[model samples]
Target: MFCFQCEQTAMCSGCTGHAGVCGKTADTAKLQDELTGALIGLARSVDGNANRPTASTDEAMLAGLFTTITNVNFNNQTVQDMIDRILAEKRKLVPDCTTCGSPCSRNDDYDMNKVWNADADIRSLKSLILFGLRGMSAYAYHAMVLGYSDREVNDFFYRALFAVGYDYEMKDLLPLVLETGEANLKCMALLDKANTETYGTPVPTTVPLTVEKGPFIVITGHDLHDLKLLLEQTKGKGIHIYTHGEMLPAHAYPELKKYPHLKGNFGTAWQNQQKEFANIPAPILFTTNCLMPPKASYQDRVFTTEVVSFPNVQHIGEDKDFTPVIEKALELGGYKEDQPFTGINGGHEVTTGFGHGTVLSVADKVVAAVKAGQISHFFLVGGCDGAKPGRNYYTDFVKQTPKDSIILTLACGKYRFNDLDLGTVAGLPRIMDMGQCNDAYSAIQVAVALAQAFGCGVNELPLSFVLSWYEQKAVCILLTLLHLGIKNILLGPSLPAFISPNVLNYLVEHYKIAPISTPEADLKKLLAK
Candidate 1:
């Protein structure tokens, strides 16, 4: 029952004992580890057997990998069943090659301990690649749902899984690590294309912080496809859909937002759900991760789908039928009148949808403002928000930013200040919202373009990245940033416990990475430099 896979691990070390900080039981952790081991075995089998997976086999691999992601699944039985299925599929995929006299190494299950307990330097590099791929797989899984699949991305999953199990050296693992970033970049581009083509390019859309009165559904997690399905099913019903957590970006999508029932976002990041979802009259649907254990008051009303699951919560199956959730919302009957909700800062609403496409579309205007000296500095204040107290630095950092500075944010971390009315600076929104974690790709794109336009290195641009990480997706995004040699990133609320001293030193010396300090102090230093 030892787990250190997330930013909020117990005391910044590992989570052990009865339950994890995220409320995951020891049993659940063991199940996840078993699922991961089975996936490794399946990868090994694939090396021996050349035949393509049956539909169930493919589904098993996708769901099995996704299930082990932080905060995604919590059911021991489900995870074990998934592991069993993966083993069955492996047997089917490589039946004859098991007896070969030659030690054919095409497919073999890797012992995770090999990587987890390797030399600090090798382990750090491999962890970066493995976790990065895990995050990328989530994005790939989402885009795949919309019938937008990439051969390179999908094939790499197997290759990466194979590497995770293999006895590869640091030299061998390092390239794969960078390749994860490269592959993720492409995966994100595919998602951006899917989202833009399906929902139209996200424009500068302001989402309300206030939750409307009456019966409403607060949906969280990273699945827009599930949200879209719910939106379609709930159309014309009295039920109102409020985006929660990662789903906040859905408001920016013209296709999803066109529904009158699709209301504003309901709460902050995923970590606050224990309190946020408590005693709410409406049912909530979790389409993805960072799902903390639900409190008793709202547990009955929680609905899970896709790879996300909890012990007793009602699960919407493959048919995507949401009748149970709808019934729960109706049963709760909502508030007698419209209930009003406010953000952490007590703001009535927040703004979102300032994705790269939107920001870059107005690139000329932004550049003009910068050249004119109307915009003093640009701060990319974004990443996964956590419950750790130090996270307030983000809020204060944004608050203390100069009037002429622009704050560009993404992911749930923006919840800390998205509600703040920073107002416009030099004709551009002072606080710009780039779509979800994956949309970090968009930020990178804008940075590269700005560097090229200014005839300087990206590091030389008047831009700084103050990032907060909580999960594997953030891990992958950071690697992608490093792959491009973006330096001097301010990462906090704390550094990863999994990072050994030597590895940490390597990053500090090579990348000039540092943990965050007080907002005012950090702001002064960033600007002073």
Candidate 2:
């Protein structure tokens, strides 16, 4: 097995031989590759068939891609099941392909090994397109959950998938990479609209880190629909709910927060789950990725839903019945007393929900502060968190940013310093936690709004992007930035292993994207720019 679709690939290269760094075994990784290959075959079938994409085909596309995302599904059985579904869908579209005497291999499954062994430049470009689609799938799936779907986003999946299966050269594949970004931008916007319209626009809300005594459930991942379901099921049952990881933003939604028993957040980000979940006295539900293989001590306390699955874990089905998780929490009965958990910085609580709507509403005040010299700059520092050694760079960087600058952040990476009180600038907290990973849409909105208010392009404004990426979601978000022609991004704790030297050089020369250095040095260099 060989895979390098995540930031923490083995030794900064592809994971090979056995288990991946994410604890994905050789068998499971290969199964995911098979799943992706089948999906591409389905795309090809739909691309040439008389039938157009149906709801089931679109859903299978989303689910198949989403299953391959790092940390989302570690169960080989489920991976094979998804592959079977994709093949069945392909057969549905092109029934004659299997028995055709003059068969063209166009409808046959793609050999992923061809991609893994392709020329370096071609391989890098194709990797970008494939990974970007996987990332976009998460956002698209979330939107579909709320009954929202974009035809453009759905159609682009087939185009991109077909390109991956075909022998596209570097030059031809390059535009598809950016096109994936453009498509993902639309996908994210659809999800943003779905979320805000369904749950109401998120408002500024402070959440405590303390877990009140009682039976409680901890829901992690970026699925608000799942969170709402769990919250509703556990309602009036003496079982409180605590948002964990990306679920932290759910607290800001009026529909979710309306539950009286919906309590505070628990622990830090996903990377810290093994240590944090070890002794937590309640069951944890995983709605999506960032799920670590459960430890023996807490194995029975873990539950999974949607595409996130682990061997032997309790799974909530499409019916959204969370009874198994609710029962586990009841049996555990939580802590004997209220546990006052603090964040990494020892702060008792952190805040989130400063999304695009919240920030843009105060656009005039932000512009006035900039004009009055009360604000120096704006920094968007956000992405997924990992257990990599250099991750603390984000915490240190956020710590050392000038007080006059506002630090806008999203995703689990913000857990590194969200608890730190960066104080207020222009009457707003210096650190604004904008929703989840998809909420990068909100950050983009705020940036465009700021640029408009300041009478300059986004790059010319007093703003800089200091991003840290861990998985495909971050990959798609970065592509969206490049698609928008935003420049001078400082990305780290390390660059992707999938990016070949030529592709890296292309990004460096064309977009001024650079690896992050020391916080002080980067701050000095960015300030100078």
Candidate 3:
């Protein structure tokens, strides 16, 4: 098996051999590839039959793509189940093809290894499209959970999937790659609307890292609806809920936070889960990606739902019945006394949910601060976090930002500095957490609003993006930024292995994309500009 779709791929190249660096075995990796290929066949069959795609088809495509993302699903049986479902969908589209004497491979499953061995330039373009779609599907899935779906976004799944299977030129694939970005932006906007409308717009909320004693449930991943459901079911049962990883933003929403049992976050970014969760006396549920392989120490305490599956783990299925997870939490009975936790920086608490609404509501004050020289620059320091060594660059970068500059951050990367008491500029927290990685939409919204208020383009605003990427979601977000013509972005711990020299050069020339240097050097360069 071969995989290279994440920042922490083996040695910054592809992961091959018996198991991936992320703990995905060769069998699981191969099955994920087969599942992806089958989904592409399903896409081709849907287009070939000239039938309007069914809702189930769209969902299957979304789940299949999302499942293949790094660290999401590690169960081969579960992945095989998804592949079987896609194959059935393909068969339904071409019922007679199974027994046809003259069979054409037009709608057959693709062998992904072929593309992996293709020319680096062509492979890079296709990789961009495929990986971008995988990331976009996560945002779309979350929106669908809240009963929101965009038809155009749904259709583009098939259009992009078919392109991946068919032989396409550089010209053809590049537009599709950008189209993936355009579609992802729409999906993210839909999710933002779904979250705000369903749960009310997020506000500035400070959450402690302390876990109160007794039975508690820790949940990670990007699903607010599931967190709400769990919060509702666990109410009055003495089971407190602590958000972890991407779920940290749930505290800011009015409807979700009203539950007194909904306590603060539990851990730093997803990578540290194995160590952080080893001895915890609470059951943890995963509702989305960033699920590393559970160690034996806490494997029995882990529950999965909404397409996140691992072998022998308790899975909360579509019924959304979290009874088993709740029971596990109660049985653990948490700590005997109040247990204190802190972020990577050792601060006792952190703040989150400074989304577009909260930031924009205070826009006039921010403008005044800028005019008065209380704020000299803005740095968007966020993205997916990984186990790579160089990631400390983010911690240092945020630490070294001038005291007067505001740091806008989102996703798991914020875990690096979220607990650091950076104080505030003009009554605003110096480092603002803007929900999940998908909340890149909120950051974009705030940037766009700042530009409009300042009467200039977004680039002219005193803002710089210092991003760290791990998986496909970061790929799509970066593409969206490029689509909006945002420039001078800094990305690290490393650039993607799939990006050919030519494609990298194109990005450098057109978008001014640069891998990160030292925090002090990059800070100086950004500030001087």
TM-score of every model versus the real structure: 0.95, 0.99, 0.98
The best-first sequence of candidates by lDDT reads 2, 3, 1
Candidate 1, pairs of clashing residues:
44-107, 44-108, 110-165, 209-349, 213-338, 213-339
Give the Å error, residue 172, model 2.
0.6
| Ten-residue stretch with the least lDDT total in model 2 | 227-236
lDDT of each residue in 1-529, candidate 1, tens digit only: 7777789899888898988988889989877777777787776666545586665666677777788889999888778888888888887887765787886655555557676677877777767777787788788888878878777676777778878777688789777877887888888889888888888888767777666667878899988999999989988888989999988988998888789998788878888898888978899999989788787787898999988889998889999999989888888877787667888888888888888778878888888899999998999999999988788989989999999999989999998888888788887779888979989988999998888888899999999999999989998898888778888999999998778787788778988999998987888888986
| lDDT (tens digit, per residue) of candidate 2 on 298-373 | 9999999999999999888899989989888989999889989999989999999999999999989999999999
lDDT of 1: 0.84
Name the Cα RMSD for model 1.
2.0
Give the top-scoring candidate (lDDT).
2
- Expressed as tens digits, the lDDT of each residue in 75-187 for candidate 3 is 99899999998887777778888788988877889889878999898999999999999999999988987999999999888989889988898888877777888899999
lDDT of each: 0.84, 0.93, 0.91
**Model 2 ranges with Cα > 4 A deviation:** none
